[model samples]
Each structure stands twice: as C-alpha cells, then as structure tokens.
Target chain A: MSEATEQNGKHFPEKQLWGREGFRDDPYIEAESLEVAGDAPAVILPLAAWLGLDDDVRRTSNRRIGVFVAPGESIDPLLDKLDTVPLIALQFPAFNDGRSYSKAEILKGRHGFKGELRAVGDVLVDQVVFMLRAGFDTLEVTNPVALKRLSASDLRDTPGYYQPGRGSAKTAGGFSWRRTPAA
Target chain B: MYRYDEFDHAFVAARVEQFKDQVERRLSGELTEDQFKPLRLMNGVYLQLHAYMLRVAVPYGTLSGRQMRKLGHIARTYDRGYGHFTTRQNIQYNWPALADIPKILDELAEVEMHAMQTSGNCIRNVTADHFSGVAADEVADPRPFAEILRQWSSLHPEFSYLPRKFKIAVTGAEHDRAAIQTHDIGLHLKKNEAGELGFAVYVGGGQGRTPMVAKKIRDFLPAEDLLSYTTAIVRVYNLHGRRDNKYKARIKILVHETGVEELTRQIEAEWQALKESDLKLPQGDIDAIMTYFRPPVLPERPEGWGALAAAKKADAGFAAWVDQNVTPHKNPDYGVVTISLKPIGGIPGDASAEQMELVADIAEKYSQDEIRVSHEQNLVLPHVALADLHAVYELLLADGLATANAGLITDIIACPGLDYCALANARSIPVAQRISERFGAAERQAEIGELKIKISGCINACGHHHVGHIGILGVEKKGEELYQITLGGSADEITTVGEITGRGFSSEEVVDAIEKIVDTYLGLRTSKEENFLAAYRRVGAAPFKEALYGPVSRAA
Candidate 1:
C-alpha cells in the first residue's frame, strides 16, 4: 500500500503487525481489520464505529444488523458522527442479530459516505454477498476463510442483477440507475 | 387493489433480469456467498432453516386470480407443493432450491410481481387494511397512498439502509385491521371539517423486544405532503437512529431517547427542506393513482341473504363461522369473507398448489377476481355478494381453506419463529398449535367470542403479541422456555399496548393461564358485546391476573 495518503494523524492506531514478522518486528500497521488483507498490513477498528465510510454518506439498512443495540439509541446518529473516516468495520456481535444488515446499508445508502465498508465479526459465507449488497465494500472475512471456494456472485449467469455500491462494480446491465448518463 | 401499469411492469421485469444476472454470477463462482447474500435478499430470497425461502410481495396483500394460479404453479414446481403466507401479508415458498430462485422470480415478474426488498433491511412490502377501500367504516381507501408509498420507496436511491429493516402500514378504516400501531410508520387517513385529506401519522411503533404503540407525530399531515413527509421521517431516522447497537437501532429507540416531540421537530425541520422538492404528491398523480383502486362495481342485491342468515343462525357450526369469519362491507347487500389461512392441524398461512388454484378459481367466479391477504393471515374476498356467501364458504371448505376461526381464539398470528427463521429465539408455531387445539372446539371458541391471541416465539413480536387482546411472548428463562402474558391490548383505532400482569408461566402452564384469562373475561363481562378487550379494560388486569396466578401468586 502507498504511504502517500498516510498522514501523521492519531485517529486510528499506527502499529502494523505482520504475520510472518511478528508484532515485535514490523510495527507500522496499528490496527488490524478482517478486510485488512495479509498480516501486519491490515487495520482494525472497534466493530461498532465501522459504519462510516470515505465516499458518500449512506446510513440505512433493510434487514437486521445482528448486533446488540441498547435502549435509548439508534444506529444512524453514531454514523452521523462518523464524518470523515474512510473505512468503517462492523461487528456481528451474534449471528442471530439482523441489525447489522441495516448498518451496512446505511453506510452505503443513508449516509452516502463512500469509503471502504467492511464486515468483520461473525461474517459467514452465508451473509457475504448480502453484506456486499447492503453496501459493505470490503469483508474482513475470518476463520480460515477459503480463498478457493466458489464466490457466491460467480454463480450468477447474468452479472448485473442490481448495482451494488461498496464491494461490487461489475454487472451485465451495469446498474439501472447509477449509470454514467449515456454520454 | 393497485394494478400494475406499464411502469410497474417495466420495473418488475428489470428487477427480474437483475436477479437472473445475480443468480448467474453466483453459479459461475464470480461472487462469494458473502457477496451474493444481500443481492438475493433485496430480491426477497432467504436461506432459511431447511432451505432457501423465496418470499414474493403481494403488495398490500392484493392479488388477482391469475396471480394466485401462478403462485400455485410455482409451488407445485419449485417447492413442496405449498407456500406460507407471512404476517407481513406476503407468501413464502419454504423449499425452493437456490438454483431455481431465478426461475421463481421470473415467474413472479410475469404476473406483475417480484420479491424486491421482501427480506432485506429495505422498505418491505407496504401493507394496509385487508378491507381497504370497501370497509364500511373507511373514510378513504388507504391503498392509493400505500401504492404511492410503494412506488416511491421502491428501489429508492437514498434511505436504502439504516440500523434495521423498516415496515409501514396504512389504514383508512376506523377499525384497525392493519395493525398500524405495531409498524415503523403507520398512516391513518383522516378528514377534517374542511374535507382536506390529512393523515394522523404514528412513528416508532414496532413489535420486537421493546414493544410500544407508535406515538402520533402528526395529527394532520396534509394530502400533498405524504411523500415528502415520509421522506423527512425516514431521513430523520436515517440520520439520527442508532448505529452503535442493533437492538436500539429502530426509530422507536430514537423516539424513546430524544423523545417523540424532538423526533417530530427534527422531522419537521427535514420536511421543511424536502416538502418543496419533487417528492410532493401532485394532484394529477394522486387522482391517477386512486383511479386504479376504485371499488369494484357492485351488483344489486338479491333477497336470499336474510334466509341464509336465518339458516346460519339455526346451524351452530355455520353460524359460528359466519359470525367470526365474515366482515361488513361498504355496500349493504355485500359482505367481505375472510378465508382463514390457519386451518386446524395445518400450518398457519400454508396453502398448497391445489389450494391456491382452487382459491384463484373461486376468487374469479365469486369475488370479481380480487383477493386480499390480510395482516391477520386470512384471505379476503372483499366484494363478495352477501347472497354468494354460502357458495364461497362451501368452495373454501372443499379446499380446507375454510377454517371457521376468523376472530375466534384459533385465528392467531404466529411468526415462523425458530422452525424456519434464523432470527427467532423460540418456536412459535407449536405454541400456536397447542393453543389452537386447547381452544379448537367450535362451540367453545364461539363462546369465547372475538378475541385476538397473538404469540411471538421471541421478542421480535412478529406474532404481534403486543397488540393481541391477550398477548403471549415466549422467552427463554434460565435455559427453559417460559411464556410471558400481557392483557388488554388492542390493535384497533383506539390502540393500546398490552400490559404485563405479573410473573410468566411455563410452556405447559401458559395455555391454561390464557384459558383462565378467558374464563375471567367471560365471567366478568357485562354482555356478549363486552368482548375480551372491553371486559379487561372495564375491570383492569387484576381479575385476569388473579385467575391465572391464583390467590397467593397475585399478592406476590
């Protein structure tokens, strides 16, 4: 990754830990995210604050986000506070919770904030593409996630079912609405 | 019923192709399951307990005979010959293979339908009063606005995602058949002295763990401002609702924290900006949309209804069914027949291919080819001639769709719960079944009178226990299944959230407790019309609580 965009800021941790070279050796990557590929090169954030992205603000969801939401709160205001962060990773908390899908969707649709949105916790293959469609641009897939297993989107005969914002860009019809206006 | 115009058809067709492509991408290994889940869900597909369940939108629960036949065809071909009608007034095929979902969606699109946003956290299928335009008490048909909401919320670019899935229900009738109080947004059509169309808006009403009746935000939101006003509310929710915790993410939590007044103020502020946008409903558009939902032409009445009524009175079985199952229609000569989806020993809302086909044929012959799946999980022949009641009942009986328990205790709202849903915390159906069996006797149920017994396996309250005159919520207490009971709840125009009496009951004891509550109501009621809710309210929950817990427990 290029160090150009890397600024001397204390927002996220800067201690990068590498797999081959332990945390004792390479100390550049501060936080590690499931979406942060490889070893010491990845970054991680508190699962809850991951709804904010870099591009546009989208902060809504259709299904459950699969996280515990305490009383006297909603998910969007927390996202509203995420003004400028580029990548936001969410925690599943539990597989049964459906609130996370709404969180991912909000990051893409409601806030319209277009940074790297990743699903880090309890993200099974079952919910991978749903996370993508709900606007998770990156999936910090864990638990020995098979790289060789057939991708769910690959099973589609026609690529462009509907245009997803965060993770996917390819489709047959190429997004019915987000097209470049037929120049 | 809103008919699909060219635009609607085009939209469905486009969505179908989009899903087809999505399916192809999944098959070709181009997308991971992680990548494919949301795409498929947006098209209303879900991988459930046993297999992939494809839910098709019935759009405010309205369907044509042809649509029913297509559902039947798909059931026969793609599923185990049956489909489940949901509390949201949609239908689900429980066993469709993942490979065939595209085919199912294709078939659905052919009949002006698609499963779009049926499952995901997007705007779900809009719901309304099953009686809708033809209810005797209605001032206006809410379906036109429901349709308008459906169109605007359909594939909306913004507000696509939030902290959780959203639900909207509208009603024009004084009787709240749509269960508007439990929805995220409930719109009640109102007409003031000026006769200007306005809506009494309720926000933050939901069924999950924290069940609260939606607070009224706007007593009179004008006609022209429906879309923009809704936009403002959704936007406010989108902007302010919680992102930290999923449980506290619904608008209800927001309203609870910021208070409804503040939420309303924020919405008003947002509306100020959007009210002038293109989102405002134009008179021409409103007029045009309302045209499609014009009441079905009624035929002059014949004189046999009186005779039929007399016969029904003499025959206890038929009388009980008629009293519970039939609803008053707008026309004096007509009555709306509610075909119960909950047949005894049969799954609630499960209709086989043959059953769908039979109902379709009956709808075409009897109800002018219009059918509405109600939020109560019953099918309604909205414009059935009163004279044709006997024939429709006979036909329904032949197909096992005629379960004479409409307002009776067996007419229950049960979520698929743990049996099918991955989100469920407990099993809802078996409890519903046990309750149905316990109250199954026609004479006994008739004696109980119109009582709504709603059970949700978990706090999601999909079973609508919160609004049930007698609401049962199943929760796990220390690894054992326990049931909590609430009383005096009503989902009508004078909606009130149910109040929990005291300690919960064990699973085996829950039904007995409910029977005790009913017994108390019967013993205390002033008259037959002093129904369960009315009786409970008149005396309060103390009597029922005393009966269920016995003397010592009541003091505790």
Candidate 2:
C-alpha cells in the first residue's frame, strides 16, 4: 500500500510506481523479468524487456504495464503492440533536455497511443502546460516546488495559445480575426 | 504594421504577470538562483557583469513611432538614459536593477512589446529583411511569415528547453540584405516556375566558435508548408541534437556531424507525417495574415526627384548624406533612409533617450509612422518620400544622427565586450571606437567605399565578426588583451567565413596594423570603385598578410 503526501498545499495519493527489483536504483538499467502475477501492481520495464516478454506473460498480466523510453530510441517496432501497454513513461534526463517532448508528440499524435502517457523525471512547473499540450496525462514531477505550483490550476488558466495543438484545451488557435469582418 | 489583437495582448499580459510572480518568488527565497536563471532568461533578463541587462524584441525589426517613444521612455526611466540596439535587431537596456525589471516589463507590455524568447534556447525573435515591405527588389513581404513564425515559436512547449539556442531568419529579396546564410534556418521567399510564392529553405548555418553557412535543404517549399516543414526540422533536431556537449548542441553541429543527406532524410520523414495536420497553413489564413502587412497608403509625387536633385545641388553635406544613406524604394517617390547609430568615435549601436525621441518624431513626420532596426546596428526610416530627404537629413543633422557612412568603413558593428558582458574574454567597444576614429574622415570613408568592420569580444560572435569583410576578434593572451584580425568574410548573397591572418597584436598596436592593412588594400585595389572587400576577394589574404606581418619566408 502507498501513502499520499501534500505538495504545494494539495494532497495527491501516490500512484503505483514499479520497476525491476534488482535494478530499480539504476534508473537507466533494463529489467530481467516480467514475473508479476495476474493481479499484480503496476510495473515499469525497459523497452527491450517489455518487447522480449513472452506473449502469455504480457497477455495474462492483469496489472498496468509501463515502459521507459529515452531519447534517440525508436518506437517503430513497438507501435503494433501498443495496446498491450497501459503506460508509456518518457524520461527527461534533465529539465532542459527536451528530446522527450517530440517523443511524446509522436507517440500520441502520430502513433495514436491511447494509454496513460506520463512524463517521468525532471518535470517542473514551467513545463507542465507544455507537457499537457504534448499529450502527457500524468507528470511524475521530481521537484517538490514544481509539484506545489502544479496545484494552483496554472495549466487551466493559461491565457491563449498561438499554435494549433492537440490533447489540451486552448482558448484560440484559428484565424477568427479576419473572419469576423473587423467589427 | 501588425497590431496586437486581443488574444495577443492577453497573452503578453499573462506572460508579464507570470514573470512578475517568478521574480517575487525569487526575491522571497522560494526559488534558487539556478532555478530563477532560466525563468529570468526566458523573459530576456541577463545578469551581466555590471547589472541586469534586459533585451526587448523588436519583432522583425519593425516598430511604430509610438513604440520607439516607449523604448526611449524605458531607457530614460528604468535604465541609464541609453539603450544598445543589438545585432539581432533587438534593443537592450544595460543597467536595470532586478527589482525594477517587472515594472520595466509592465511598461513594455503596455507598448505591445515583450522580451520573451529573446535570450532563451527557444526559437529566438524571427528576423527578416529590414527593408521588407519597401524594398524594390522584394518578391513578397517576409514580415508576415516572420510574424507567423514568431507566434508559433513563442512559448513552444516542446522546443523551449532544447539543448541550445536556435535562430531563424527570412529574406524576401534576391539581393539578400538579411544575411540569411548566417542564420540557423534561412528562408528565402521566391516564386516558382508556375509563379507561385514559396521559400527556398536553408538549414544548419550559424556563427559561434565554429562558423558554418547554411546549406539549401529544399529548393522550393510551397508557402503553405512552411510551419509543417519548420516544425519537422526542429523536432528532428530536438530528438537527435547532441546533449552531452553544450558546444556541439546547435543544429549546425548536428548537420555537420551527421551528414546533411541523412539529416535531410530524417526531417523529410518527420514532415511526411505532419504535413496534413493543423500545422499546415491554409491558403485563406495566409491571405488573412498578408492583409495585415499590406502597404500603407502614400500618394506618389512626380516632382519628388526634381526637388531632391535641387536640394542636393544646394548642399554638399546633405548631398553626401543623401547619396550614402538613402536607398531606392518600390514606390519611386519614396526612399529608405538609414540613420547611422555609429557616430565618429562613439559607441556602435548605443542611442540616448533624446536621440531615440528625435528619431521617433522624424519617423512619424516623414516616414509614414514606421521605423526599422537593422541587424547592422543602424535604424531605418523605410518609407520616406524623396522630396523629404533633405528635410529628414536636416532633422538628423541637428540631432547628430546624420552620419554619411551607412555601409562604409566608419559604420562598424561592435558588441558590448568586457564592459558589460560577463562572458567576454577581452574588450571590444574600445577597439571598435578606435577603428571608427581612425576611419572617421568623411572624404577618406567615401573613397574607401562599402566596407564592413565587425568586432567581437569572444568566440560567442555576438558582433558577427566571423562574417565581416574585416573581422576583429579580441582574445586575452597572458592577461593582456590582443586583437586578432581575420580577412575576407562576407555575409551577402555569397557568404564566406573570414580566415585569421597570423598572430594577434597588442591593443595598442592593433589599430596601427588595421591601418597598414587598409593602406595595402588602397594601394593594390584595381580601381577606386573596387572596394576593400572586392580587392581582398580578387587578390586573397596573401597580400593583406604580407602587409601586416612582413613577407612570409619559404625557407621554413
């Protein structure tokens, strides 16, 4: 059982976070097993291990299965099997490293991945709105202050958007100026 | 001019409020300096050696007379009475307290100007040809596209925190006054064989420690495909650009290390997937945006030429100013007037509040309420009638704004070096000031013709020394400031990076060395009309090197 904590004056229950028992400390390491039971808790596996799991192991698993994808790694081979995974955590190694943004967009907009797309690692307050726009449903923010700032409804009250984007609700995106005949 | 709509106004206002809150949080110790640095930088605040420097974006270098007055107001009230216009067509206030920045930004927001993305890793203020709507050679106005790109790139969620900064430039003319080749992504608006407007896209060009001119990736991308294509390119770069080494993080390095052919393939593959999305510019939307930039109404004056000619014959000083500073406009009656910010022995791009106010008044009276800031660190009144040339010149003369050397030797481009910037290795302003003084003689400058001398304090190349016809780089050698001279760089249609000519000189001797090189160029030039750059291009660095460092020995 997991406990909840208060950040930025808002309380959030901890979601089931799972990884390989032996290699959990090494954030970048691959898992060796997919041995969870049919009703096991959520599990996070490296892309290679998720792809290597036996069909029975993946199909019979009742828990949510997630995979960690890094920058420069291709997900073309995993597209066809996207239905099997419930979560795809795109890792941002650092706050300024933005490769995973494009990765998330491609996963959502191009491949039509319908699972819980979470941004993991180095997530901050300023980037949350962009993360939401880029199709991230959950953000595992590592910064406590960033988590606090997220509770302020900062993402909802953003004034307007200039670009046409998917996944997030934006106030304006089209050329309504000229269409209204300059009243 | 594109006026800010309600959405645009609301967006900037919200951004101002957001930054204000961030500053307050930093002051209250809720955020550390490391956390606050990027936040402040995204709003165009830099903590320089002296104090906080705020850079305000003059989008596409186009501003209204009222905007100019507001800039002057900011300089006078918030800053130290003067502002420095930069190489990217932005204006920087050098001395502002951190506490006063929020108020300064609020002041800027009132004028529909903000400092967003002016200093961050995101797509920077999109620059275009300064003579965009007025140039006689332009096929289409590039400002509309630049504006669209500006809106799209602003607070771009994904690309905001790229490995390094990115810059994009657009040109609508064949002559390329925008120096598109030196930008990270260069867009040249042109017409295809079917007489449809589009862009010739160039990618990977930049100047820092390792300078590379952009290479053409698409010869003719349809106008509607601009956003899709640009997004695809940035996405590919974002995913694949080097992150381990900050130096090799630019798209130029990516294009250089991973061969252009492979990079092109990757970008094309991404674009293929994104082309039909909402990112694609609909034809009607393009037309709508174009409507905003339609030329302002100004009647043609047939007698404008005769009036200008008569005025020229009456005054030689005004005649010299007219001959050097005025450029032909698409409307025959009007002319583009460049107000040189580089006064003799003065700072390169600094203008006092009084000077800015006077310029604004002049622009309002004669130039149809429009002004443009050039990347050359000069200001342009882009739509002055030929009949008002003398009147404008007289007004400029009164305020010490009328410098006859527009593209000539005295009009140098220099960045604020050790005096202001924290990253500078040596001073650059003093070196530029000395060079300007050496070439200050009007007749001598006129004889020398069109020559550009650019100086930089460090390898960051803020002054664009890498592309100057005569480039001067300041390096610190054993605690002494030495100037290294590079010969034969040009940022015109045919772009070339300059090559260094032997060892550097002491700050005391560098001016003398430059004079000797100029003397050599004057002596060896084929004709008086053949400028220093033309002569250097024809004869190469050998003669210039020999003139500076004596004859090289073959007995090595």
> Judged by lDDT against the true structure, how good is candidate 1?
0.73
The weakest ten consecutive residues by lDDT in model 1 chain B span B154-163
Q: What digit string (tens of lDDT, one per residue) describes model 1 on residues A1-183?
A: 111113322132332211211112322232323245244333433334334332332234221122222222355556654544545545454333445555565556656766555554445444444556666655543323222222322322223333333444453332232222121
For this target, which candidate reaches the highest DockQ against the unseen true structure?
A: 2
Backbone clashes, each candidate = 112, 1
Once all C-alphas are superposed, what RMSD does model 1 give against the true structure?
Answer: 9.2
Residue B214 shift from truth in candidate 1, angstroms: 0.7
Q: Please give, as one word, the docking class of candidate 1.
A: incorrect
lDDT string for model 2 (B100-189, tens) is: 999988898898899999997889999999999999999999998998899889888678888789999999999998999998899999
True contacts kept of each: 0.00, 0.62
